[model samples]
Target: MFSNTPISANHFLIKQLPQATAFIDKNFKVVFVSDKWVEEFNLSTRDIINEHIQDLVGISSKQWENNILRCFKGKRTENFQENYTSIDRETRWLKWNILPWYNENESVIGAIVQAEDITAQISKEQKLEQVQFILKETNEIGKIGHWKYNQSQDIFSSCPMINNLLEIEEDSKLTLDEYIEFYKIGYNRNTLSMAIFSAMENKQSWNEKLEVLTAKGNQRWVNVSGKPLYCNGKYIGIIGIVQDITDYVIKEHQTKSNEHLLKTLINNIPLHIYIKDTQSKKLLANRSELDHCGISNEADIIGKDDFDIYDKELAQKYRDEDLEVMISQTPMINKELSQENSDGTTNYFLSSKIPLKGPNGETTGLVGITMDISDIKQKEKDLRNLIKVSSEQNKKLLNFAHIISHNLRSHSANFSMLLEFLIEEKEEAERQKIFGMLTDSSNNLMETLHTLNDIVTINSESTTNKKEVYLNKQVHKTLKHLNPLLEENNATVITAIPLGTSLQVIPSYLDNMLIQIISNSIKYKKPNVRPEIKLSLSYVQNYTVLSIEDNGIGLDMKKYGEKLFGMYKTFHEHNDAKGLGLYIVKNQIEAMNGKINAQSQVNVGTTINLYFNEEN
Candidate 1:
């Protein structure tokens, strides 16, 4: 100790520190180890200090050991990774740094080394790489990209695909404001801003579609979604994704435009139109419907249920029908409906309701249209009435034919029997009496046949003979023709004819009609009482009114009201009362576009009013 002790120089002096360290001696034995090495190997320093390096670290592979031995033989090696087994029989990764050591005379002594357990770090790196690879594959397949925003830093970042979707350069850096500016100028910006704000402020998530202007000045559609990250009630910036959807957007717009055009065309049609939901009894109507209901605008009726807008009973009936259509899942065409509106007016509609179906052919709703049919309905009613009248007339004609045949055959048979009896008898007196009776009967039969032929002709001919004639002059002519009868009945004819009163009529028919009517009045004059007949004509809009009032044996209209104009229907049993007069008069007047009606009582008098079309 007195003299400088000879230093037993060893490369293990630097390598055998307390921290993780390793050493190789001149003979390449692991002669030194640190505390971490001792713990790692599950051995004492005394046990591993003098062991060969391969045995200490359990490097059983010859190839790996050769590399380590070569490194120890003066070849400097740094950060070499290899698998090694600890004393506990657990294998793990270890990294070693190796350097050759030398003595003062520059002779190679051994090598110094440092080792670190890096199994956890290497495993984490491998897992991260795998996750990144999977995310790349998913992004490519889905055509989606993730994006992030940092509010505090005012920075926006997106994955590469997002930039591609927006047609932006890969290396472009965008702020949130700049990114929002890329949205189209109209509703797209508003919708996107609302979605983003809701997500960031309320810690919510939203998905929406928006149009964006791309770098190439082309517009594109994209589906965007975002979710806010909140920590302790404080909102962090949003993370989201965007997907290109330009094709879908264009298709949707085209479909909507077509639908709108269809609706517009339907609204412009001049008919009542409406639609209804299948299950709910509600009406969706158009502008024409508003006009039909006498309302100024759609707001007057829109959203009001059928019960509120229509009569309760009618609404219920309509709802029941719609329910049936929906249940049957069929189309109903030209179904007639009589509906009452809110204003207490009724309308006729020809309706068609079709079931709206889902992809599976299940009924989801109903679409209905109603066309205004009020005018058509009116025309149909008129046609039915005409048919009824024609049927009645046919029956009357049949009855008339039977009467004529029976009367004629009865008279002929009587005449033939009388002649046969005359042939059988020889008395000249009896023969002459039979002859007189036969003559009277033959005369009566001939008169009846003539009347029947005249009626048949009048009925068969068309009643459209139209011409302009002065009604006042016709009345004066009729009165003049009846002057002799009036004189014999002590009748007084007073006329009150307005100047220029005329009507559309057949000239000859009108004269005959007036003659017949005036003759009847004078013929049925009260006996021992002077008959006073008043004839007055006045002009009304579209018509000339002729009123003939008589003071005579008034008719009992209650008994012979409907038969007044019927052939062979005589109200008076007078010798000259043919009953054909009024019948012919009515037929002639009606044929000339005129109408005649009578009001009478048993004792008072009769007033006959005739309306004729005013000459155009």
Candidate 2:
């Protein structure tokens, strides 16, 4: 203790001190102070000597005061840190040290006090605490954790977050092998093992998405990354991070599955489905559309427009329609259209198109579907033709009914007159004559009945199955039957029908028809000229035409063309003309789904052409 020491010596010693320091007497008055003390307290050029410690520090605390008193009793006291107000009235932290000074007799004389301004250090520590807190919260929220592996010691260390992510207790410490067990078996485990090994051996870094099983047996996806650690160019350990990515991975998988399902549905649909961009270029096409466009691969049709696959005019039309739909933001539903093919056949389609919109409701493109309706069109046409045929048949039935009524009435009138004459006769000869007339009338009525029966039979049996018949053979058979008539008319018959000229027809009908027509040609021959008849065969489209031409007294076609094939219609006056031969022929031909027409010139010739369906 410098009780006898010069104050100047004490000042010299304290001034040499490199820390904020002060020396005080037992009465708690400062004896000398260091330059550091002045600088730390922000003091101007003024003396602070002989000042009480409380006055210099400007803080009133019983504990601080008691510590100073204890220092005077030869006890040393130290405060690591203390909060106090400075001379400027700003709050600050300080570290204090107090010790009793010793005299030559080893008795305590005064205390030496030292203080350190630690405000900056305290502020730094507080900032560090705040950063640590933020980091912990971030880890919990992001499902992230960090880990390190010490290669030399074979030790693996991880943060508490890792345990939480693995669904294990916070205090659980797992060995290297045990930690690996958390990775899902098979590919996930193998991948992590390989990545770690490679990182250590090659000093590389790796990042991978892998599956893991938690301690509670829950499946999860995780992103794992590792980098080899080095210290002084020597491999020390591996440091890495792991993040829970289950939600993200699952959402991605679901999106992929939905896309696949949509693609399959579109491709399997029967309609031709296609998608186009705002520029009217192909963006997507289903399998049905690819097949329709004769494309084997989907990629081949990408970016193509209608002009690439269709005629110029049709392509332009299609593009125009697409533009209209997109611009109007409207849907064209089930529009019927016809397309003519290169083969000169027409196909029908039912097409629909709708504009596609973006998220902001702007028109982005268009989607279209076209269905082939060619089969449906054919069915409609067949239905119309059937209705027309039914109407024509009804008209024919009405005409037949009128013809039957008129013919039956005539027969009945004749019978009545003959019976009256027989009843009024007075002599036997007269009675016999009336009876003969009655018999003749009865015969004529019976013949008319037979004719009616023939007509009825032809109509009823129209749908009978037909057999193949050769035209030349049938014509010869008919001529042989009509040889006597031909001889009477001195007719020269020429059979121009080719051999093997076959037709599917009712054999009996053809035979009867040939007899009626050829006989008429012979009966109506020019009075002075010999009759000449020619039978020829030809084809027109799906019909096989058989022409029977005759050089005889032809009828006036212009005058009687309307009733050429009408029942009970005769163009010329003749006793043998029953006005039934051509009508019967026409009915027979039609029953076999054939047609009949005549070209004639008076006194020149008549050609009766029969058209049979070659397809049948």
Q: What's the TM-score of every candidate structure?
A: 0.49, 0.60
Predicted model with the maximum lDDT: 2
lDDT by residue for model 2 over 1-616, one digit each (tens)?
A: 4455665656677797988988788888877788898887876466688788777768687877788789888887867578888878899888888777776777887877788888999999999999988888887788889999999999998888889888999888888678888998899999999999999889899999999899999998999999999889988989989988888899999989999998888999888999999988899999989988889999999999999999899999999999999999999999999988889999889999999999999999999999988998899999999989998998989988998888899989988988887778799988888888888888988998999999998988854578898888888888888888889778898887777888899999899889988888887888899889898888898899988899888888889888999998887878988899999999998888889999999989899999998666
RMSD of each: 13.3, 9.1
Per-residue lDDT tens digits for candidate 1, residues 495-544, read 78777866777777778776776677777777777888888876667667
How many times do residue backbones clash in model 1?
0
Q: Tell me the whole-model lDDT of each prediction, alpha carbons only.
A: 0.76, 0.87
Q: Pick the candidate with the highest TM-score.
A: 2
Number of clashing residue pairs in every model?
0, 2
